[model samples]
Target: MWKYIKWGFRITVLIIVAAFLHYTLPQRDIVRITGTYNRLTEVGANSIFYASPDSGTTTNTVDRRDIRFIEAVYPDGGPMVYRNEDTGWIWPPYFKYDSSNLQAEATNAISPKDKPEWVAVTHYGWRLPIFSIYPNAVKIKAVAGPDVRLIPWVNIVVLVLLGLLVLMLWRMWAQFKERMIEPAMDDLNNTLDAVDARADAARDRARGFWGRLFGRK
Candidate 1:
C-alpha cells in the first residue's frame, strides 16, 4: 500500500541520519605516542613521563623524551600526553604548535594554569606517582602525525552506494505493494461499499410499512 511505502521511506531516512553521526562525530585521535626507557642500570635524568586524562581509568605512561605533544592536542583534543621531568619541561595542554589546531578545553579539569607535577624520573620508572594530572610539557615544532582524512572522492563513492541502495529498496517495495497488497485492499473496499449501499436501500423501502404498522401513520 502507499501507506506502507511512505512509512518505509521515513524509516530509511532516520537510519541514514543515525549512521552519519556514528561515522563522523566524536572521532578518535590517531597520533601515536612512544618513548624509550633506559635499557640497563637506569639514570633518572633520561626518562620521560606522559598522561591522558580522557583515557578513562586506564591511562598511558611512557618514558620517551621525544613524544609528540602538540600533535595529540591540536585539531583533535588528543589521545596522549608528554612530559620530561629531567629537562624541567612544562608545556600547555591546549597550546598546540602542531598542524592540527587543537587547544585545551575551556572546561577541562587539567588546564595550563594548573600545571601538573611530573611523575617518571629517568632513573626509575618504579617511583612514578599515582596522582592523575595533565602533562605540562610538549615537543615543539612537531608536525602532525599521519591521519586518515575524509576525502571528498571517498564521500562521493559512499553517496553513490547509498543512492543505489535507496533506489533498490524503493523498486522492491513498489513491486511488492503493486503485486501483493493493493489489489486485495481495493477489492475489500469495493465489497464493503456495495454492502453498505444495499443495506441503505433495504432500510428505505421497508421504513414506511414498519412505521404505519406501529402507529397508524
Candidate 2:
C-alpha cells in the first residue's frame, strides 16, 4: 500500500510539473488577426489563470476588470482568442509591460478573411472555453506565409537548465543519505545490539544464582 502511495505521489507531481511547463512555455500559432477590443470581463473560477490585480496593467478589483482581447483565425479557419495582459512582477516571469503596444500591433496586423495576412503569434496558456479563458499573446510579427516554422529556442534552454537543477538536487540528496543518514542508522543498530547482549548476560547471571540456590544445576 505504501509502495502504491509513493508511486501515486510521484505521478501526481510529474503531472503538475508537465502542466505548468505547458502553460508557461511560449508557443507559436500561424494566424491572421481579425480584430482587437476591450471588454469588462467578470473574473470568477478562472481568475487564477489571469493576471493578478496588482499586475501593472490590470485594474485593482476583485470580481470584474477590463481586459484586452485579440481575435484571430488560424490558417485552417479555426478561431482563436487571446487575452492581452501584463504578467506583472510575479510568477511565470514574462515581465510584460507593453500590453497597449501589443494591442496596437495586433490591431495593425488585422486582415480581412478574403485577403488574409499571415502573422506568427507567440503566446502561452490554454484556452478553455468552459471558463472563458484564452491564451495570452506575448508577441506578434508578420510572417511570409502560413507554412513558416518557428523554433522554440526558449523552451529548449529552459528545459535543459531545469533538468540540470533537478539532477544536482538529486545528487545532493543521495550524498546526504549516504554520508549522514546511513552512518547514523548503523550506529543506532550497534547500540541496540550492545544493549541486547548486556541484557542476555544479566539474564544468564540471574538464572545461575537462582539455580545454585535451588541446587537445580
Task: Quote each prediction's TM-score.
Answer: 0.38, 0.91
**Tens digit per residue, CA lDDT, model 1, 1-217:** 9999999999999998766533332223233333222111222343223322222112233322222222123234334443322222232122323212222321122323133211111111121334422233322222233344423453467668888998999999999999889998999999999999999989987896798788874
Cα RMSD for candidate 2? Answer: 2.0
Candidate 2, residues 1-217, lDDT tens digits: the string is 9999999999999999999999999999999999999998999988889988778555646788899999999999899999999987888689998899999999999999888899999999999998898999989999998999888899999999999999999999999999999999999999999999999999999999998989963
Worst ten in a row by lDDT for model 2: 53-62
Reference-based TM-score, model 1 = 0.38
RMSD per model, one decimal: 16.2, 2.0
Best by lDDT: 2
Candidate 1 stretches greater than 4 Å from native: 1-21, 24-71, 75-155, 211-217
The global C-alpha lDDT for each of the candidates, from Candidate 1 onward, is 0.39, 0.92
The per-candidate count of clashes, in order, stands at: 12, 0
